[model samples]
Target: MNITINRNSETPIYLQIAGTIKNMIEKNELVKGYKLPGERQLASELGVHRNTVVKAYGELVSEGLLTASRQAPKGYFVQSAVNSWNFNNRFFPLEKMIRYHYNEREKRFQEIFNDSVDKGYISFGGIVMDKKVNPAGDMGSIVKHMLQFDEDGEIMSFYHDDSERLKKNICHILAAENMYVNAKNVQIVAETNQALYYLMTLYLSEGDSVIVEEPIVPDNASIFRNGGLNMVTVPMEADGMDMDKLEMQIKKHKPKFIYTMPNFHNPTGAVMSLSKRERLLEIAQRYGVPIIEEDSQRDFRYTQERLPSLYSLDQYKSVVYVDSFTLTFPYGVKVGYVVGPYDLVDMLGRLITMTETFVSNMGAYMISEYIERGFFAEHTKRLAAYYSQKLDLLCSQLDQIEQKGITYQKPQGGILLWCTLDENINERKLFLAAKEKGVLMMPGFLFYPYGYQGRGHIRLCFSNVSDQEIVDGVRLLGEAIDQVKTKENCDE
Candidate 1:
């Protein structure tokens, strides 16, 4: 066996060796059941450390590309009948890519705060509502009133395909946003996450392809990958997804659908321009691929006129629109709705039935009543204004840090700001250090399907943290980063 290692490459020596062997097996250059050189012999032949050889073999074993037999004096050999089962075929690569980005951080979350039940740490991590901004008093009264009404059998015990009242409320909400659609065209009552899952499962299948923005919401990536579809990521610029690359990918891949969060896009906080929106729809129409327009955070914009949703511009009914009040009203409500072609709605409704029996009828009723009474709108307006103030405060404090190595965009509307640290800093290491300091932030890599692509970036949520905590947390972060850099320089 022959193997080459690149010591100068960023890839570890063990990975280089393991990758070579895996490639050889994949190409049939090394046949099934072929014996690999003994670890000591291979280490000597390759002029590398023995532990490097052991690590390489361990990786192959985990990948199911090789098997070890201690009965035969501890030797490694390629698995017999390797082609009998395609290990890669069962693996969801895209989901793995997305999970790989966040698994470490999530594990760290469990490790650091797993014991603490209270919310004492400065949280720039989770997407949360400002308790002060939400009309919890009014919502509590509504819940109490609904519970009292349960005695009259008017509390919604069953699911209706089209909750007429909820549909009407959704239509009115859309109209306020400058998107006019009849209640008849809207499908009421499913959580936003479930709605997205229904759209993917109903519209796509194994081996099908979909186009999504790079550094997308990790959950969406996981959903698409787990559904056994290929997700091709289009890079984003300050304006939104790179239209040129998007069109190029559309042509190259001929994807079945394109998923986008046009307003205050997740992870990047870049809003799509109206012209770009028009262009995106035109391109989708040209390619004959349906667009899943996620307007989840459109209502959270802090500055500039809110752009019309893609569904607002969809004369051809090619856009499947999904939105929710989870970010604004109540996270526990789990109420979201989708508006699209009637047939598509019916299809998704059937999927909803098969999956969760039905969307929460009682929850739907409460939301509909809240909207009809105008509380939802007023509450959301106030919530947006409050978040805007917090956003301003957060950015102002971050600006005063005067750190030469830190860079971030001041988002106009969304709860999160994506930040890039000095190139020499590692966000994963910084995350660990920040955890020790009781400041929590989401590493930027979690927003993308590719790990390491966002190595120097981290996401901070302003909607949940207090004004004072934001100031103190940023200072602590600066100190932690400086310490990491100094240590890295010393080690080098």
Candidate 2:
């Protein structure tokens, strides 16, 4: 195959090579089963670094446009099936990549749990909060009251808009958190998942773009990618999303929205500083992009002072806020609310109606009663103190592990901590091996839009497991890491 390289062009050398190969495949110059020159030979022919050639090949493989196999020291070759390639017919490339690969990470975690169950090993995977932490008895009383006062057959009726009383209760709750929005400005009830889905569907479309934190909530990115929006990720520092990179991407891409978790961000519990929050709003206003502020974990702050939400700071009403009770109270209470400009809320409500026709009113009523009685606030405070101690205990144990091999950050709040293994370790394999030993954790890759980007990172949840289990789980996980490292070294 003949390929041209343009070192003088602004395009990166590897991308140029990948583009040339892609063009050749499209033009039928590189026929199915065609053999390409070896990496060193390609490097020589193109007058580029060998790593550049290798990177080009890796990109091609990732795009599913090329296949590689080993045949007794054989080199790479074009898949004979390339004749069927149809770029035009392709589902958006990034979306396909995310769906095919991201689910694999989830599957690996699930497999670990299954293996642990079979072997009677105590598994510490999944975001299962402590049962004792849940105010199930209180919630049960609320449910009983709901059934007794079930009037006008509203309880049995399928209604989309939450009961007006519940909306008022939610509004009051937000006000206490420094987010002063009117009940009329908020849409009362959808599952938190659905709330996000409605917002994305209302604002984004095929060929549109969105900016996200690099290692964001995995499912959020997967949904965005699958929706056919190009997702550009900006790396997150301890302070928050790197505002400089965010500004550059916003200027370059002019994305339709920016999805962020400002409070106790998922996977990594880095909280956005107040100054960054103000600047972030300024950038969003300048770029004319709406900010989706997920304050799901607001009630879990371990510190003495509360952080102000973006919605509270938005003088221009450019922030679209979503909050949920799933993590705080009972998981089965599927109630979440979104607050934004009245116009945007109206549009989103219409979208929600079109999809879910409204949220469950009974669930809304029960949650409202829970809040009305002030049980929600008290319970959350208790949970925060409890989890704070657990986090401290877990981090102490994790710190004793050989630090030369592993890295982790202590999260101020939330249930998860992000840990990175040595470059030599493969988290995906470690996740599988850990499961076999009755331990399960979300691999770091599951938090990114591109699953492969976070290859050496894993997320551990300390909220669900007991103090003893935290110690045991970390010990088993440390052992699993050693085994995976040995296996990877042997393969190399």
Question: Highest lDDT, which number?
Answer: 1
Off by more than 4 A, model 1: 1-118, 149-162, 402-404, 452-455, 486-492
Taking all chains together, the TM-score of candidate 2 against the true structure is 0.76
Model 1 compared with the native: what TM-score? 0.75
Q: Estimate each model's TM-score.
A: 0.75, 0.76
Q: Please, what are the lDDT tens digits per residue for candidate 1 over residues 1-492?
A: 778654422245787788788757755688777889989999999888899999999999997779999996568888632322111101111211212233443454444334232367777876766666765437776666656446666664443333777788888888888888887678765567777677766666676789999887666676777677788888788888989778766765668888998988887898898889999988887767888888888778776687888898887778989888787767466678899878888876666666664666667777876877778877777878888888888778778764746788777788889887775676767776886888888766565663332225778877667788888998888877876663232211
Candidate 2 lDDT, 326-443, residue by residue in tens: 7786657677888887877787666666656657677787777777888888888888899998888888888888553677778778877888777667676787788777787777
C-alpha local distance difference test of each model: 0.73, 0.72
Q: Ten-residue segment with the worst summed lDDT in candidate 2? A: 85-94
Each model's RMSD to truth, in Å?
8.9, 9.8
Q: For candidate 1, what is the lDDT?
A: 0.73
